[model samples]
Target: MLKLESLVFDNGFARLPEAYYSRVCPTPVPDPYLVCYSPQAAVLIDLDPAEMARPELVETLAGNRLLPGMDALAALYAGHQFGHYVPQLGDGRAILLGEVKNAAGEGWEVQLKGAGRTPYSRGGDGRAVLRSSIREFLCSEAMHALGIPTTRALAIVGSDHPVYREDVETAALVTRLAPSFVRFGSFEVFYYRNQIEPIRQLADYVIARYYPELAARAEPYAELLREVARRTAELMAQWQAVGFSHGVMNTDNMSILGLTLDYGPFGFLDAFDPGFVCNHSDSGGRYAFDQQPDVAAWNVTKLAQALVPLLSVETASAAIGDYPQQFGRAYIERMAAKFGLPPGGETVPLLMDTLQLLAQNRVDYTIFLRRLCDFDSTPGALNAPLRDLFPDRPAFDAWAARYAAALRQQDSADATRREAMRALNPKYILRNHLAEAAIRRAADHRDYSEIHRLHALLSRPYDEQPECEAYAAEPPDWAKRIEVSCSS
Candidate 1:
């Protein structure tokens, strides 16, 4: 077994001023129980399985005990939620347990979400419900399996306690690891407070830790902002291509390393609805499915504004101006992969036109895209998984004709195209209906078999798992619009 010292402790960020974080320990919970464990995450952190799965270690993970050298602290940051500035929204429900290096020598932040309250609790119990914990755990693993950059979940620990939201629910904690938990909001806090020195130090630390290559540049802060913008745009593009709706694109939820974090009220589009809003608390559909790119652009502009003090006006403007074009290029490349076509200038408009048709016709997002993998010149041979998507065959025929014509010019063989399309198009997504089913099974019956099954299938989402075909189907009538709350 690899000992703890085998993993390095290069604590660069902790060397900064103490005001950036609050030195506090997790307020332990009672009678912690293991809910789930990630063998893959253990391998990444190189933790011994026997040690990690032990009851004592599980209790430590649940915030009921402290681990050796673990400096659990609540990080400080501010964020703009739904365009409303919340100047004091820090880690009200999370604690950064500590930092550790993996076998690959990469530093990762180990955080405990719902590990009890801290100084930043804001008068609320800093505990997480089992329902939300399950969703986050499954989705983090599912998103990673889909090849999207995201924070990985280490384990989940459940307790015999209850928390009140809409009703009483069992509480749990999730241990998640990431390269850095710093956010756009972290910089915003300093800029809002007019604390430029701390902002400068924060920028320098970010540049050194995440974008080390930029630290040597003449304008490292400007360069750092641009790197984050470019990476964030690409991440948003990837999300759109997969029909993902983050539900909450707040600045704090935005990772400095461009990872998907804070999975709350998130959903995958079953049907192609551009205006789909998964978050029930969002009275206004500000962060809809199609509006993610715009939200990302807006957030990057906010980041750019925060760094303006460190940059010349012209440099800031230039970096800001590149967002649209950069997002266009990145989004198109992902679309090309989805359609099994080589990426180029012409492919963009064609894909956009097809998307317009899909949105107009209200087609099933996953099924429509998945079927396109088998699209050929023989029009009538195409199979429709859901006939309601197109009222008649002629509508699909027209689009299929155009698509087939484009495919014919490709240099790649049909088999290769089909294989590539299958690889890019996921066979499974965390549809709200499916996620609800899994959560219900666990919460009501204490049966985690469905959760385990769904996890296994989602891990290989692009493959044809013949036995799991039912899991990929559309939601039932009742689940079509099940409301999801911010609390869970």
Candidate 2:
């Protein structure tokens, strides 16, 4: 029902100087086929979900053809990868297929990842494998459903073309949607090159599109830096609260809008180990579960440094100084909500103590949090299920007593507290084991039912879907066989 001619395209980033990006067309892949599509994402751009199955849609998605008014380009940027600064790291395997304004008049950029090699492809084949594409497609929608800010996937297209990573995997492409693909590294590239004009121009363009309110301010650019810092702090807090370990917290992966960007080697904690590292490539654990907040702060500091040319050094430093407290406050508030306590309440120490107990016991993070919703102020209420989760029963009992006491101090009814906690705690997360099961089925058997099923289940993560209870259970020992890395 959707017509490509009806869509309005705007090339905002391409309107910038040639140095900002390289105008290129995605290399056509042979025999393109549709793998899966997201109906929820389809509505965002006013596209009919039924239209996604059309051959024309598949062709456009797979880079075999272009939609009307499309102006494809690859963006240029730099990044600090695992503490080392890379002077030039751009969209090597992705092509921005221009921006489309939906019926609501809001502009969204449609990008095809793993399309083909660009000027930025650093001696590597620019193609995404089926395994990683499926992971990203599922996880992006899952993050959005969990009420976390992130880029969304419209559809995924596959091809018969062979791309080599760990194996000679078949190629695939994911159509990702975002307001802007600009990253913190977008500014860093110019600053490092001593090209102050491009940096200023990029900042001005970002302000005009994303932060228009700041455009009228006296120090719009400084305010822009401060706003980005605040959003990044809050985003990191959300990730920590949800037990998500973004394996690579590199500067390039940090979105200027603070949405979780570049979903590679990302994993939700299976157990409450703060030191858990999901990426096999992260041998040093630079991006461990507990280290995310600090890594995010460090990345934000790099962004602040890039803005020094536009704002006073003192102003930028002051903005960077606010990150820690901002992160601390946001983390405390989110964690407190999960434990059914008021923001900045007196029972914060009890919440911290409980986390330590969970970590010590290696309790399953998602299960333990969801189970806490059943806690009541009564003495024996939490003894059976909750206490059994910990090896040290006495330690857990002591913590439960404190938690019950804290609950008694509050005036809310038992049901009210339970409902609040349930809302904050999700019953489902995109577990690594579950993702692998789906991946194996798709890759080996060419069966994609599991992918569609997961997309449906994860879209309502907070709700208890009894029919899919097996998806919520803790991972078995065999599940540990699944390993993710930067290659993912």
Mark the 10 consecutive residues where model 1 has the least summed lDDT: 3-12
> Candidate 2 lDDT, tens digit per residue, 1-488?
25655777778899999999999999989998898989999888888898887898899999888877899999999999999999999999999999988878789999999999999999878889999999999999999999899999998898878888988888999999999999999999999999999999999999999999999998998899899999999998999999888899999999999999999999999889989999999999999999999998899889989989999889998867889999989989998889888876676777778788899899999999998888877866755777788899888888888888887877657788888888889999999988898888988888889999999999999998999999999999997888899999
Best by TM-score: 2
Per-model TM-score, in order, reads: 0.96, 0.98
Q: What's the C-alpha lDDT at position 55 in model 1?
A: 76
Of candidate 2, the 10-residue stretch with the lowest lDDT total is 1-10
Please give, for residues 1-488, the per-residue lDDT of candidate 1 as tens digits: 45543544444556689878887788788888787767777677777756665777787788877666677788889989999888878888999877887667777888899987888789989899889998999999999999999999988888868888788998889999888889999889888898899989998888877788998888887778778888898898889989989999999889878899899989888768889998998889999888899998999888888888888778987877788888888888888989877688567778988888887787778988777776664445464543346765676677777777777777556677888899988878888888888889989987777777777788899998989899877678989658886886
Off by over 4 Å in 2: none
Clashing pairs in 2: none
**Residue 165, model 2, lDDT:** 90
Residue runs of model 1 more than 4 Å from their true location after superposition: 1-11, 379-389
